[model samples]
Target chain A: MIDTAVLKQKLGDLDEDGVQALLDEFAAGTPSAEETQQVVEACQQGMEIVGENFEAGTYFVGDLMYAAQILTAALEQLKPLMSAGGGQAAKGTVVLGTVAGDIHDIGKNIFKALLEAAGFSVIDIGIDQAPSAFVETAKTNGAEIVALSGVLTLSIASMKETIEALAAAGLRDKVKVMIGGNAVSAETCEFIGADYWSKNAAAAVKQGLTYVS
Target chain B: MSEEKLKIREDLLAGRVPKRVFMQLRFTLEAACGLAGVDLVKAHFDPKTKLQAYRKVCETFYSDSFPIENVRWPEVYAPLGAKNWVMSSTGAMQHPEIESMLIEDYDEYIEDAFGTIMKKILPRIYPKLDPALPGAPLSFAKAYQRQQATGGEEVGAQIALSEEFDYAPGFFVGLFCEAPFDFLSDQLRGFRNITLDVRRIPEKVEAAVNASLPLMQRQAIPRNPIPGFTVFIPLHLAPYLRPADFERFYRPTFDKLIREINKAGMAAFLFAEEDWTRYADALAALPENQVIQFENGDVQKIKEVVGGKQIIGGFFDPLITLTRSKEACIDEVKRLLDIGMPGGKFFFAFNRHVLDIASIDVSKLVAVLDYVHEHAVY
Candidate 1:
């Protein structure tokens, strides 16, 4: 019904109008659930290219953010079409939050948008979230990956607490943990007991894809 | 003050090597409050108390001048119901990028950007600021006046201190200003909105950025240069842009704002607040006399790229100071001085902010500064 490869290229190209027009055109024909899933996977692949471009320094923080926005809106336009044929199944669930005592969210939001673009169903618990909140959400949602974000150095302490809570809840072994933000370092990551730490959102998304795949 | 201590500024401006490497540094509100053991909340409310604490902090550290203690009256914004510059967990006032206070559509803001700030956006950010809301016109005027009086009395005291205190290098007062990119995202569209708006409505975003610069500049830089004062701009959002986008959207206004300050014979000090390795050439492109404080970057690279045209500083890391052993911390200082000092234009300071006294080993911090004062000489 639509050239999924072309749509993916438009997404990687960050051609928002082109991506939207193509998605709208594809949806008008009422694609099948299986076919729509292919389109969605292609979009995710396009976002992978977007992430790659970001990693290559061709794109920037704004470009990654803008690409995610396009992916999000494009997904919404395709959602009903896939839902009518049968619901679009997310690759996996990822629980994300900025740990307690920090209110900064730009980094967290960027990570969330990119995670969503990579086709994971992300539950963003928002800023200043407690460890208990993370445990409860991960348990309830059966999240496979828990991503913690913060900007303040104080937030590393909270990230530690959140991970410990996950361990205490017996959910630690079940989920892969990623800690990120200005405050996070490999030293802090190892100390905090996170499985991985991302310096940028694109690398973080790449990690998310690795965990799910 | 001795001619030698103050001579550093003139030497730096004239592009000459001075007798000794100068020292200039800043601590965030939280760090200052925690270091002094002063009540953070009280410091936020009472300028006199904050200044006293600040003075003690400067003196205790044997600082050549006070840290940039430009609260510029944050409590004044509180009554206006400020969203960004509100109190934090430690009671220290900070402008965290929480929710951007501007919730209105871009078209209206795009149409007249500065006017939207005055008529619409400010009201949304500061809910208590309606002059026509009946009983009290902006209700905080009386309170603001009282606070100003208290602050004014302290500023008057600093003059007397300069005469008596040898450590006082006099105030290098700065009028705090925001770049249009910073204000547009921080105050209005925020990170997400502005991020998308660049792609979604490039024309509107450009219009808003272009229109807001003049208003931001007029309100920030002094027409006649104050003797020790400079225009301080903390570059926030520009680092996140790819150089092309930054040049298109931010470079012109940022360069112009600093150039005007320099043209008026006042040095404009800018805090290149994040990882700006990509923009080092762009940063070096600003007028050489104007000062630039880097929060993070290669000291050698900044010097090599800038070619000692400007006074270079701010590569000493607080993370190393607070967390590393005393020897390690001092080694980093020696490393910075080795790279930075040979030119005679280096300023000794921490690269990143030490947000509080929580992680600090005072002896280590003291040792680092003491070492700088001792070894970092021409």
Candidate 2:
């Protein structure tokens, strides 16, 4: 039997291989549910460490990438079991994508992970997606929240156009629209008639969840 | 030393640059380059061309001479497009059968899977195999030679020629530190996921960061010489991060990275791209002699935070030179100078890289510099 305390400490330490091994051990039916929750708590602690490092300027993009990798690994083990018991349905469904003419996916991907963890079912439309694609996907998925991300300053217009098209399609009011990315702000959100302007992925999910609820 | 070079360097050391010259130079460069002419690639071959052009434009407008420095000139190199894929380069995850073996818990397989796909497609889409390309083995040798020729003696010959020049110093050949969360949010995690991750699964986010620090630190070497000061680029952080959230998620990482870097005998330069006025005090509390360069941050607030202990750069908005009239450009520069120059330790320049635009007037920049140099106090 694996020690839940040890596993929790290892997860808090952000020990990828250790956590993975414990997860594997758990998959083999070694650890109890109580142990699994400990591992989850430890993982959360690890994120706080990451946040600290980031604020202090000790961490960078690559570190965040690796952290995400480790977290996803542990989550892989926990997500299914957590969902099985109707633990948390995503607060809402967000159909998110980087608008057309922009290939930057790092921001969009981060937002997706944050949103999913926040209990929102995120349908990522991928990068360089056309405006029509967003509207069509929102309609098809019946997604209550539509999130548009554009890093390129030039693509801000495309986001607006997408919003306009949604209105033209008579579906604008039906879905809550959120706009985010480096160039986006409260002013841009207002100018483009978006319901919310999220400065980061976390803020986006929070706002999306509220709107949906 | 030429007064121009000395003045600029002094300002940098003191944490501020005279405003008139800074504004004038910016306006002149903007006018001369136009939007399309600031070719980042060409600037690599001869950085002096851009510098000289700016100087010439300034001379034309204000009729002043700015001496060129013998300091190591800046260059640009190709990015190792595949370095990010080095871990997944083996295509181990791409095989559908192997991918299928991935248990539901290993969701990172999706990233591995996608990386495999992109690596396969890269060759077909951009099929140019130039040995001279950055990240190629030969490129390192070439960079070494260039460094040697330009009076760089310390480990200059060791630089890989193909390395891309992302910043002035480029990638340190030795040990370096980075904020882990920034790494994930800016370089790896698509923005959407990072934001969601921080709020929803803060634990997973923290764990991922911890696992990578040792790996990053392993890359750090003691012999690495950081010139000027350490620059913490908050480009991705500002638009996405809240002041309170920054205090929680980012401050600790920043503190650790700075402590380690400082212990290794280097200074920190916190470069905030967005309006960092809200978090200035938190940033100021880090270490002394640290430089804070703000892209769009308020100058007065930045000054108040650092309080003359550290250097501060950037108050002139790039948009002024890019879109506003030349007269407006001068006024803006003068405004920044009036406020920023009183305190020393200021290095002046546009908030960001000088973009090429056609309508910008170069002479205004020269005139501004001349006016500032003539009027600036010690």
Candidate 3:
């Protein structure tokens, strides 16, 4: 039996030693389904704490990435156990990439980790993607959402072009589009015909989840 | 020097408003020429035609811009070629692939500088920058070759144009030296890697930044101080870190760099990007009279935090300048002037460069300057 409160606190503090102690105990074999769920829940709660710290300015983007890595490491350790216990399938498919002419992907990569932890299958089309690629990926994967990421104002044109391409491909109504990055805003989303835009990776994951269930 | 240009420096140093508001419109020659209907690629080789085109664009579009003694005319008129003229070793013409990871292992980078940077890092990341294998280090030779290959023609053309220019010509000062963390995040390690490394191996990150300090100082420090000039330091990776992280990983080196730059009688023109509202207090503690150009932070909060010490230059939004009506533009400028221009140490600039000339209503820009000159007087 693991004390989840202690686990949550340690994970939130990013105390690798303390968090690893709990994860090690669970991964040592013979943990109940309840225990595995609790461990996953603790990681989720830890991410919420990170998001709070980020909003309060105590944690930066790099810190959030660190927290995401910890969750990823913990998940990697527990993946077999979760699978053996018949865990939930991926809730939805997400098509993600950095739009054309804008090559920044740090934010997009972080979002990918968080969304994957939340049990979404992400198809990253890589950076500097053409608008048609997003449309084609969504059509093939039957993706629930499309995420276009860029870190330049110049890419706003690309985002607009991507949405137009989706509509031209006659696949606009089937999938939701969320555009995000350091350079994107709600106004930019509207101008580019994206369904939404998020301020940070946490919100992006949350928003991506909403489109699924 | 012209009386107007002299007044900009005097007012800034003395902590008084200049006779008229000073405006720094951030535009590169390519974008400027593009706006003015000149093909920069063709014009690059055509030196005589290029100078005439530059003058025509300047007279037509940028005549109202505040003329500083250290005018960046060389930068404006300089031909596009191999970017290596500033830092030959870095190999300017080649673009680093955004998709690939430059440094796969942090330990390799930590264990050896020249060995990893030259043999492993540069060769893999930018083959053009890595001139030779480990046994024969030939960066200086490469620099010479690169200069002869690309620099002579453009340098001569730009110098000739500068010598005859009416205003004080600003020369290329030097390349930027990032605080250790920024150098890692920017060139060697990606942002994701550095962010993880800060927690996983704190000592290695600190060692890397400390080791790179002298190298950055070598690149950044000017040999001779140009009068009334400012070295533009684009502040990246700082806003991404928390207050404590910035203090530990960034601030000390940045403060040292600022102190050294000031010792040489020049100022650091920091393009303060992103939302640095959290670190405003920490930033306020830097030396006074340095220009802080805000891009996204709340101008009022920044004004309250660091306005008295630094020469605050912004709050004018480029989107407003470009997309909004002329009346909307004037209102925004007047609003910023009212908030920022009370006790001097304020200049006019946009958060980002107005890339599309059609987006800017030059008359509206003139109106803002005119309005500030008339009403926002100290």
Candidate 4:
């Protein structure tokens, strides 16, 4: 039996090789749905550790990035096994992208990984997406939330434009708007009429869960 | 050089002030030229027009507060098909397009790294350039040589311009060297891709950055010690890196680079681009007299940590400066001085400049700088 506590510890410690070694062991065994869910829960717990360490300055963005990679690899190994038996249902659907005129997607990608790990289906619209494209996608996909990310000051204006476009399409009230990036703040979120803003990836996923629950 | 300018330089080199606090005020050419009512597009292309406009702008705002001058260079505008700046509908000014990406695919980057960049990336960035055409490498070499020649001329011209107006010329070579990760992220792989690669294929990322260092050393490490000799290294991706990972990927090359610059008898102006507050303990261990210009970090905390050793250049918030009234701006300056100036190593500058021409209040900037110079003393 794989000691899941050890796996969680290695994942949080950002020991990529150790996590891989543990996952390999777990995969080689006749994995049941209960074991798979336990592994996924360990990954989430590991992410919480990564987030706490990040806040405490013991870890940095690169470390969070590495942690995300570990979780992604773990999921790839276990996702199929879980699907063959049973797995946690996705909590929500999020439509995410970097706002128009900004090509930076680091924060957005990190948030995507965290949200996915937290059991949310994400439709990433890619970078420099227009407001109309966002509105249309949200309307068509029946997305519960739209997350706009940008790292430039000019993106503040783009966020507002995206919100107005959603409102124009009569989809504003139907979907919550969340914003995250280096340039985003609570003040900017309020000004842009967004429902939420997070300074980091973990908080983004948590806030996203709150909207769904 | 004026006595005041010489004194400022001495104090800066010693990592301590003599008596009164020193201020290094900077301005974007866009802000200066806009103040002077010159068409930026026209001025950028014509050397005489550019200098004449700069001269007029300098005459208008040449004070103790306006000390540093970024010498104007005759820029060659991109052709119609590949223009990076688009003209406004009214034809009053040009706005820069979003920064274009150079590398389309990261999988091909290792191969492209070994291949001719002119054929691989340059043509994709600048549509006017053709990969099929011969002599691209020669043209690139000639352009580089021309830029070096013009850079020397620009320094001379700025010195004359400064003397003509009785302000010391603060001409320095902007030797931009990125940490290994940033070089890949900024130049070849986008941040998203590189972040993914950091976990998926860490060794490849290391190898790619290691391969690029030799070229960076040759290009970015200043060879000649001209007047106002300074190597301004703006560090990105450091704040984002874990300490061990940073030690592995960036610190070795960066330490060697600094040693090489110090051996050349040049001052290194290190710009801590993002929030490096977390790395204060490690950064404080570096050799002294380097000005680590903080763009977004706690002034008081950084002061307590690294203030004794290195020169702290800035902590004033640019957002406050841009949004606040003149009185509030001056108050902000006072607040910064209260926190940063007492130790005698602080210089007053905005965390960033108000690059939007219309948003720049020159009078407010002048007031804040003047207030710093008059009231901030050791």
**iRMS, all models:** 2.5, 12.3, 6.8, 6.2
Q: Best candidate per lDDT, number?
A: 1
Model 2: how far residue B196 lies from native, Å: 15
The number of the candidate with the highest DockQ is 1
What does DockQ give for each predicted structure? Answer: 0.41, 0.05, 0.27, 0.18
Model 2 reproduced share of reference interface contacts: 0.02
List the candidates ranked by TM-score, beginning with the highest: 1, 3, 4, 2
Listed per candidate, the RMSD to the true structure in angstroms reads: 3.3, 11.8, 5.4, 5.9
**What's each prediction's TM-score?**
0.89, 0.50, 0.82, 0.75
Could you give candidate 4's per-residue lDDT for residues B92-135 as a string of tens digits?
22323222333343445555554544555556445445556566
Top-TM-score structure, candidate number: 1
Candidates sorted by DockQ, descending order?
1, 3, 4, 2
TM-score of chain B for predicted candidate 2: 0.61
DockQ of 2: 0.05
lDDT of 1 by residue, B1-378 (tens): 767777875676566887777777666656667777788778766666676666666665655555545453565665677776765554545566544434345667667666767776666666676656663364568547756875675566555445445443422463767777776777677777777776667777777787778877786766665654667777888877867778877777777777766676666667777777778887778787566778777777887876467666786766554457899988888888888877665677666566666535677888888888887777
Off by over 4 Å in 3: A1-5, A30-38, A82-87, B1-3, B13-16, B28-30, B33-60, B63-121, B128-144, B147-172, B224-229, B321-323, B354-378
lDDT of 4 by residue, A73-135 (tens): 889988887876788877988999987766666778788888888889899999778999899
- Expressed as tens digits, the lDDT of each residue in A87-135 for candidate 1 is 5567789999988767778788888878877768999999888999999
lDDT of 3 at B231: 68
Tens-digit lDDT string for candidate 3 (B239-297) = 88866778898888878877777777777778777877777886788778888778888
lDDT at B245 for candidate 4? 68
